[model samples]
Target: MNTFSIKPTICFDTGSIEYLKNIKNKRVCIVTDPFMIKSGAADKITNIFKANKVEYEIFSEIKPDPTVQTVAAGVNKMRTFKPDVIIALGGGSSIDATKSIILFTVKILNASGDEYKKPLFIAIPTTSGTGSEVTSFSVITMGTTKFPLVDDKIIPDIAIIDADFVKTVPPQITADTAMDVLTHAIEAYVSTNNSDYTDALAEKAIKIVFEYLIKAYENGEDLEAREKLHNASCMAGMAFTNASLGINHSIAHTLGGNFHIPHGRANSILLPYVIKYNANLESGEETEAGKRYAKLSKILGLPCSSISEGVKSIIVAIKILMKTTNIPMNLKEVNIDKNDFLNKLESMVNDALNDKCTATNPIKPSKEELTQLFQEIYGE
Candidate 1:
């Protein structure tokens, strides 16, 4: 039997930030990045706290691909603050770090047998990517590897998508994050665990990304595009959270952690290559993943003569989108040293093979296959 679930209560609209006002008379702890605080985005939520008379503390030290040390520090702060509500108010990094903080804090409290109040968790995504708001997955970097932690306890109680927060995002970040949404939707749709419920959500998210990502990237001020992309991200997140992800994410996580590439960019760079690999049929039989890709291409009104042709069409479309949005088409274009990449290929392959997301991948790649795939992505 397949199980499907939507865990978070989501609010998506033009001024959804106002929902924070409902959080009254509580001690709230907000986890965010320094950029969000400095850029005045955090103020949007803080002002609501002030109006609601909610005492709050801001932990704004979260970095991109937040580390275990950073999460530990945030957990320590959360323990001392004893907040009634914990809000994650930035991009995927901040939301993911906050999730780790809450998870570990609860573990610590439970181990000590101390009475603790479970804080109401809220995720307000400042970017339209990662769907970290609704998902139970958190990607935390430890040393040179990214550990994707998955647990229902880390899922937010509420997800607030306010397009206003994404309005000022730079074009490059907008492109990167939007690609991340596409990756999530595609991976979820083709995942071995996918069900009708997940396929529906994933298809809608994919359609929205294709329809609006370019508009949002071209004109950040387009609130309609921004809102649609924001909703797409959340929809994709919900789909993947239940359906799980695939090897595309697994490979991306490994590359991002080791090479210091942005998570979204890493995913975007590896996407086309992974798609081709997943759709490949040595026995000349259509795989489930290939058929899914064909279906997606048909849904998007792309060319579809056969499964292979449909898959090729989808790949071409993604490449065009990446180029139009200025995303690097290969790892080599991202300035990573070729020698270093080759040196680390074995380790990355191992980590990717063991990734939690790999279990749900439609095609289980051997280490040798993964190595070749990585090299191909590196343009070797």
Candidate 2:
């Protein structure tokens, strides 16, 4: 039997940050990056706590592509602080790191046969990407590998969508994160495990991204565009969390961890190629994934004379969007050394193949095919 679920209580209204004030007589741990604290975004939430007289501590060491070391440290801090509410406030990295911290802390407590009270987990995304706020998956970097930890325990209890926090995001980040939202929706829509529930959410997310991403990217002050994209990001997150993801995320995880590429940018660079690869018709027969792509193309009102043509139109449109946003189309454009990429290509392939996301990929790629795909992405 197939299953679908959405666990988080989403709050997306003006002044949604004020929700934190509800936690009274509790220790709250604010997990975020240094930038959020430095840029005064963290204050937005902290001020609420202060007004409500809620005791709070800030953990601001989370970095981009959060590392195992950082998570372990955060877990230690959480154990010592014994917070009742844990607020993940920032981009995907911070939320992901916070999830790992909570998971590990619980594991440690459970190992000692201690009854651990789970904290109220809240994720407030400052950027409209990753949907990490609502997803049960957390991507953590270990050395040169990204391990995606998936568990229902890691999913947040609450998600706060405040467009005010995203107003200061730079254009490049806006473009990259918007593309990440697109990738999430598209991959979820075409996943082998997709259901009607996920498909509807994914389709709506895709429409929203196409309609509002450019507006948000071109003008960050556009609250209407920001709000729409933020909602789209969370919707895609919910869709993928239920339907799971595909090889696109697996590849992005590997590329980001190994090459120090930003997660969204890595996904953006690989998306078009992945779409084309997944949609390739073998023996002149349409794959289920290809049919899904065709349907999505039709939904978007792209050229759709046939299944193949429809799939090709989606790929073309993605390329045009990437170009318009100034995203790199290949690994070379991002300045990765050709020799280093070649050396690490096999390991990358192996990691991607073993990734949890790969289990739901519509097209199961062979080792040789994966190797070829990497080389092609490298522009060899």
Candidate 3:
């Protein structure tokens, strides 16, 4: 059997949450946060569950960059509800918390020897980005370190994608999360661990991002833009979910894990710099540079004579997008003191080196090279 897991049955468009009524599970516990509730999406889901007569409960206290204690608390709530279904109805943090809760309640509860049982999970993403609805990885922040729980079992049994839910996303989030999509695509495409299946998906996702991200960021209420961005994000998720990512993500994960930086924003700030550094490698003409850079440039309607020029042009385009979206181009803008960054540089480098994604980088960096990359990003 060529066993590879995929996401749950996906439904897109307005009123797609109605599909929740047909779910087979009995008790459904919705793991979310106050923001989604405030945005009225939580109530929409609650009303849908109520209308369907499905027994449900809501644990809406999940924090941004969820913590272990938060997930444990959610697990405790699951123990109370003994839910057959877990509905994650927010951004990546909420979805991740739901995954951890399911694992703890199903796999870890009253179990031994580090074994876990996974329950059915359904995800309704209010954001057009993150693609958490279809992903099997969960990033949980515990203390100062962000830990990734990777397992196909975490993939949701259903993904309800409604662009209407994304209509209210502010431009800043649209930019940050959309950049996340781009990073996911680029990293997955260039990963040495990539396969043919993931490559096809990554290419399509990269095209979609170049076509739609800026439009989505500029006009949140544009349903077409929102839908395209949603699809792109999902495609990127599928790509990285299979082939994994590169140092941009690995380093971003480390910085976020250690310093509590927002995952998407960290990736956004580092992506251009990382690409610049990666492109400087004299690996070989047979490497991925031509296809990688040319495809992106063509997608963005930029003309370049060489792969190096195309790479530089894409970086410039990305920087322009960041500027237009009000995303700071460097880490200093996010308030990390130069001293703190320098002080923690060694640990951050170690963490990145240890990251699972690091093994697949198109051009692996030495400690000295990584240090230089960090300094460049810091000053950019």
Candidate 4:
């Protein structure tokens, strides 16, 4: 059986953060990184608590690629504070770490068969990326691998998407995350489990990225662009959470975990190559995925009179977008030494094949195919 559901009431537009006031007199705990503290975005949330006389605590220790260790620390904080509400107030790392912390807390607090009621979970994204605010997924790092955990309990109760919070985001981050939004939307649209519901949301997200990602990247203060991208990210999250992802995310998760590259940047670099492999234009074979790519190209107003041409057009368009956004086009550009990548190629292939995401790929890839795709994306 198949079903579609959009969780988390998405809140956006100017003054959306004002909803924090509705949180009442409950004790609130904010999970975020030091950057939010430095940027004063953290204050935006805390200020509301103060005005309403609500008690709160801060956990600003989150870092990029946050590990199980980081999550453990957050769990400790949650245990002591026992907050009535939990607010995740940073980028993907902060939100993901908070989700992990909450999950761990459930295990720890309920270890002796005691019922632990979850706090009111609220997410305020500081970037127009990840869509973590609305998804049941969370990536927690352990050693050299990142675990993508999906659970009903981790989905935020509310996602506040005020663009004012993201006005200070740097250009490169804007580029990286906006491309991530495109990947999420495209992957969801072509997912094996896709339906009319997911397709509608995915199409809207893809259209928004093609139209406004660059505008926001070029000018961070572009409020209209930021708002559009922010909403697009949420919509893409909704689509992917329902439809699931594919090898594009599988390979991305493997490589990003291995190389310590930022997740969104890794996805952006691999997209063009993955799209080609899925389309199978080189083998001159027609496929459902190829047809989907063709439809996407046509939607972008590219040259897509035929499936092959549509495939080529979509690839070219992605390359063009990557160049314009200054995203590295290959592993070399991201400074992944060829020797290191080659040395780990076999394991990465196995990991991608076994990745949870691979189950939903429109086309199942073999070890040889994945290896070749990895080599090809290594670039000149």
Candidate 5:
């Protein structure tokens, strides 16, 4: 008895850059990053707006894992422009910044003296992962705290997916971000809160990750591979957005917040360990998340003699994939000292235990169990 909902406006193909010109808006704000501008995507989008005779402003200072300060800055810029539409163009960071920017704009209006509300928003995702275009959740970092802003107000009015944007993604980034998509799909499929709708999306996304991630990583110029990965990433995002995540996300968020580890890298390395930890639980337990993992393992072509063996194969495959991609398998190689983890062990466990995603874990571990898991990975 699960329930969910997703609704996004129609999107044109990669060649539909000219669609920007047809947008019937007086003032439009294009939110992006400096790298995107230098990559020529910003100019292309702005040129489209020009062709359409649309007046637009470009804000290109959004940073990775955007801070609350940065989001507020973008909001302020949005207000100054007072655009009828906000177009987000770039990777997850840029798309995520757009969500916060729009949310901040709504807050401003709710408190402002003016009765008029702000403009509509659209998302043009240049990256394949993060599915920020179709999701209602936005991750915003503030100081040392990571907060998720959940509201339908920020969901983009339209999502334009273009394979062209991912053509130049470096091999390492392709591997890293694709792993994030796989985690999203796998986590969503096993989520205690998952609905039938999300389960279907998760299964499809998992297969797509297996089939396209490596191809895209090995050959960034392959448009077909890029398109498939991009679609899979978006589907993964859609799935996770509806079902929410589990302990892997909980621990990853805390670790990334505290250690400055890349979000995908942290999840990719810890996913197998967490899955193994979860599979050790007794069946017919609080949540049968292990069943979903076993199914995913078979889908990924991992050996599965039984449910437990299937789970183990999935873990081994993940580790092997990370190795092939040159991603570090342990915290030690990522520049995090073992002593620092030992010192923070108690707090980190508590932080992850209390995380919003923790409650959904099929088999929630006690603080001691979490410590053991952290320590095992600390020295590796």
Candidate 6:
């Protein structure tokens, strides 16, 4: 049975952050990284709370990739403050860290047989990537290995997507994150669990990324492009959360976990190769995934004279976008020492296989195939 369960009512608009005004008389706990807190972005939310006379606490210990230790610390802090609402601000790291912190807190509370109530969770994304504001998944790191934690309990009660918050994002981050949106849509569309509900969302996200990702990257101040990309990111997140992801994400997870590469950059770099593998273009075979790629190519009005061409068109289009946005095309560009990558190959392979995302991939990859992909993506 196919099920479609999209949670969290999403609120968006140029001034949607003003929704915080509705949060009244509630003790709120704000979770975010040091950058947001230090750079005054957190004030965007805090100012509203202060104006409204709402009580709150700030947990600014969030880190990139959200380490386990940090989550425990956040939980410990929260246990004391015991806020009625929890708001995650900033990018995926902040949202992911907040989710993990909440998950563990609730689990610990329940295990101890103490009465506890899940806080009203609200996520406001400052970046147009990760779509984490709407998803129940969070990536928590332990000594460089990322563990993607998934549970419905972690889904936020509300998501605020204010394009205004994204205006100050750097061009490189805009490019990387928009590419992450594209990856999410494509992977979700081809996932074995994809249904009509998810396809509609994924297709829309793909179309938006193809049309406006560059616009957003070229000019961070582009209001229309920023709004569209933010919406696309959320759409892709909703699609993938229901359809599940694939090995592209699995491999990206390992790349981020083992090499400390940025998550979106890792995914974008491997995208074309993963697409070719999933579509079986090299083997001269038609696949369900290939047909979907052709459909997507047709949607994009790319020349899709055949399934293979359609699949190839996606790879080409993405490469062009990456190059235009100045994203590195290979590990060589990122300067990862080949020997270090080679030495870590087996472990990366093992992690990819074990990744929950790998279960829904259209193509089940072998160890040799994964090794080959790792080596190929390393580039000469």
Error of 6 at 55 (Å): 0.6
Instruction: Put down candidate 3 lDDT per residue, 301-354, tens digits, no spaces.
Output: 787677867877889988888888888888888888889899989888888887
lDDT agreement of model 4 with the native:
0.90
Give the per-residue Cα lDDT of candidate 4 at 190: 91
TM-score of each: 0.98, 0.98, 0.93, 0.98, 0.94, 0.99
Give a tens-digit lDDT track for model 1, residues 73-137. 99899878889899999999999999999999988987899778679999999999999999999
Question: Considering TM-score, which of the candidate structures 4 and 5 is the better prediction for this target?
Answer: 4
After aligning candidate 1 to the native by TM-score, how far in Å is the CA of 371 from where it should be? Answer: 0.7
**Which residue ranges in model 1 land beyond 4 Å of their true spot?**
none
Tens digits of lDDT, candidate 6, 250-346: 9999889888889999999999989988898777778999999999999999989999889889889999999999999998899999899989999
What is the number of backbone collisions in each predicted candidate, taken in the order shown? 0, 0, 4, 0, 0, 0
Q: Residue 128's C-alpha lDDT in candidate 2? A: 94
Q: List the RMSD of every prediction in angstroms.
A: 0.9, 1.0, 2.5, 1.0, 2.1, 0.9
State the C-alpha lDDT per candidate: 0.92, 0.91, 0.80, 0.90, 0.80, 0.91
Candidate 3 CA-lDDT value: 0.80
Candidate 2 local lDDT, 255-288, one digit each (tens): 9988988888989899988988898865488888
For model 2 the TM-score comes to 0.98
What ranges in model 5 sit over 4 Å off?
A: 10-13, 281-287
- What is candidate 3's TM-score against the reference? 0.93
Candidate 1: Cα lDDT at 286: 95
Choose the strongest candidate by lDDT: 1
* Ten-residue stretch with the least lDDT total in model 6: 276-285
